[model samples]
Target: MDTRQRLRTSALVCAAAVGMLISGCSSGSSFSEASAPSGSSVASPPGAVSTEELKTYYAQRLSWRDCGVPGFQCATLRAPLDYAKPDGRSVDLAVARVKATGPGKRIGSLLVNPGGPGGSAVSYLQGYAGVGYPAPVRARYDMVAIDPRGVARSEPVECLDDKDMDSYTQTDQTPDDKPEVAKLSTAFKGFAAGCKSRSATVLPHVSTVDAARDMDILRGVLGDEKLSYVGASYGTFLGATYAELYPDRVGRLVLDGAMDPSLPARQVNRDQTAGFETAFKSFADDCVQRALCPLGTTSPEDAATRLKDFFAKTDAQPIPTGESRPLTESLATTGVIAAMYDAGAWPQLREALTQAMAGDGSGLLALSDSYYEREPDGTYTNLMYANAAVNCLDAPPAFTTPNEVDAAVADFEKASPVFGRGFAWASLNCAYWPAPATGSPHRIEAKGAAPILVVGTTRDPATPYKWAQSLADQLSSGTLLTYEGDGHTAYGRGSDCVDTAINTYLLEGTPPRANKRCT
Candidate 1:
């Protein structure tokens, strides 16, 4: 499994915490809003295509209709399949919005993305941001979301079918020998091949850069002179890419759980491994304090040792989960990692671990299923498929061969003794990608951009706090907002200070003071 896929929004994590097991909250849709007129030309940065060539695309109007959900309208926006070939084929992007409900003067649209590179931004809007955002913020700005190209509702990438995906997920990630390594490699290759065979046309175009460009077009279609946005996890990378591509068009952008674009693929995986370890320690600390702690009422280090022992036990003999599929080490590890994304889920994780340790693997298996967006019927959302597509296209593979991974094992192990080996091996999935990487690790400094807020959780598991610091330092107008707490992203996660600062920025165009720390 790709570790980067863990960079999903806290909304999903909170869903798991609240026992909305199968999938998150459902969204209602209805149509009653008029379409926003296409605005004047939005200039592209130097070296981009001339605005004249893209006039047709920028000027096209969106026809909004009820999206089967109350209070939400959906529309499709057409963008070039390949930007270089503007006159060639096109890809349709799904866009959704809830018009501002205001007692105050309406601000412009506030586009929200919940990471995943694959997460359904539209679903996020209707299910969370559109209704759950602070009433004051929602009362002013129209909440908008566009599922980036090759994401949900758009042309999503398809990989292995359900049965094959089950086998793939159960594959041993930490190889004990040559045969195990070969088996893992074959699974990776098969996943890539399946994507190639099923989604050949759109796989290569799902890079973050392409998604960023799509955001610009969406901005124009919505008649926003400058984009106001909230992007989490990988969405932060997407938002940063947008600021870099069109600095002057950026407005009131908040990149919570920010990622550093400068890190290579290997570094990203390794850092995420360390990040998981950090979060695990936090969980372990809390777990030991509970009288019913499954790992024993011992120190955090002892809990880690016990957890590793459990993994080894599962590796040797898979635990039956009541379902046809058994709980293997990979699934259990994924389950644990999923819980690390939000502290609210720690209780669920503790219970899952308790059950797994007691020979009942149902809880852990369910958590793993949730992480993969697996439906109770065995179908899966296209989240993982698009996740791999975007991640692989955004950066070169972390390792070209098994030997490289073997060589880096020590570093990975040092970074995360429990998860490092699996994360190190997971990075190899992109090595078998059919398309070459279209992007590389580089610094992004949107020099002429308006103030951008970068939020970080001190114990964030997916995107490390250090990454937010790095991203804040990198962006020319970036300001850092630190949440001295746990969870993936900070805003809308119960931190009054964090929400107030971000809300102030969005409403009044005033960013939080640099290095402001909130609890």
Candidate 2:
């Protein structure tokens, strides 16, 4: 729930994508009974696994069964817990697929990942991608998804329990003074410690590189010579990593809402702050024209001031919701940040802001709950925990201490006057992470890879358009497809141009022209 983590976690496509696919239903499934055994760890040195070592994994065939959801088949695939030692402890990855409903000759399996480093790919496949992707695309390609290690249903990393998590989510992220800062630091330490205590076995191995390797294993298991994928948000990073490691294995890939792998963690967080600021201004401009503008009717600047003032007021005196927990400044900020991911949520945000301004914090609090994936019964999905795990492992922390955060506050605030301070402090959490970072900022030039499509939305709040541009430039064969619009991702958000370009690329293996723009 920390805003700093929102830098990459913002690519979480579940909330909006699932909402569009299914009404009034949870997008996640509890695959606990099918989860792999935990508590096994081994030191596997980093390097290529010899083909001999990987033969067992590659030769294994999936035993698919009815997934209990009509038209879907579920199965589990075994991968090395540590790839360096393929014969060592193994992990089971949950995979789901809806075979191609073909009128045209079947092309191949199309793997889709909807951006949460922690997002449940299985659930996404069931709730959205498998059912909601464009018909022509789905008809020729067997839609597929795999829950990566330490994500939902795949030996998930457990941090704080439900009650502790609720308290953690409510923890004040933007400290006003020394004691508050110390308290915030303690909360972060506690969350990290909880993860270490609960998920020691899988902590070190859930890095993005590891997940990308798992994707390759999946590709082989699916009998596909190359990977045909559509990765959004953090999934873009995942796909790019796969291409970087195995350039020849790259097939049709559409990396929507692309993330730049070359930027350091702090820069990523700061850039995202600016991205959210851009999105908020868009919202503000739209809001002030409405009859019930809670922020202000004067100008976007006035609206921002009012929103900041409202945040300050809530910080001073938390607003009470109908429930036992009141809406704190942290929760309110999360609520607003959640809405920024998709413009579709703007009206909901307007209503929530209006209700909060009228002293009812329930609406905003509900938005916060949705962002955290907290269920009505107060239990939570493993999304946030896995988000922290994967992200913390993928790159070094944004800040090593409170002093660094304090020093960077001015820069962050300059980037985003409203959400900057909170986001800067939120970046401090990963500094207390239990495992050392296994990866670092590095460019991914997938030299000799097949042409990969990179899609960017003009006002994408989470993964900014600039990141997409940077990613496209970095990948040797990457083609940029620009959507001059708002939202976290471009394709399937009702843009015929974007969809047509991607579908054509998927079917015909021809990427759109470089820098193709669509409104």
Best by TM-score: 1
Model 2 residue runs over 4 Å out of place are 1-45
Tens-digit lDDT string for candidate 1 (215-313): 887777677778899998888998999888878788899998889999988888888888889999999999999999998897999999999999999
List clashing residue pairs in candidate 2.
none
Candidate 2 matches the true fold with a TM-score of 0.92
TM-score of each: 0.93, 0.92
TM-score of 1: 0.93
Which stretch of 10 consecutive residues in model 1 shows the poorest summed lDDT? 16-25
Model 2 scores a C-alpha lDDT of 0.82
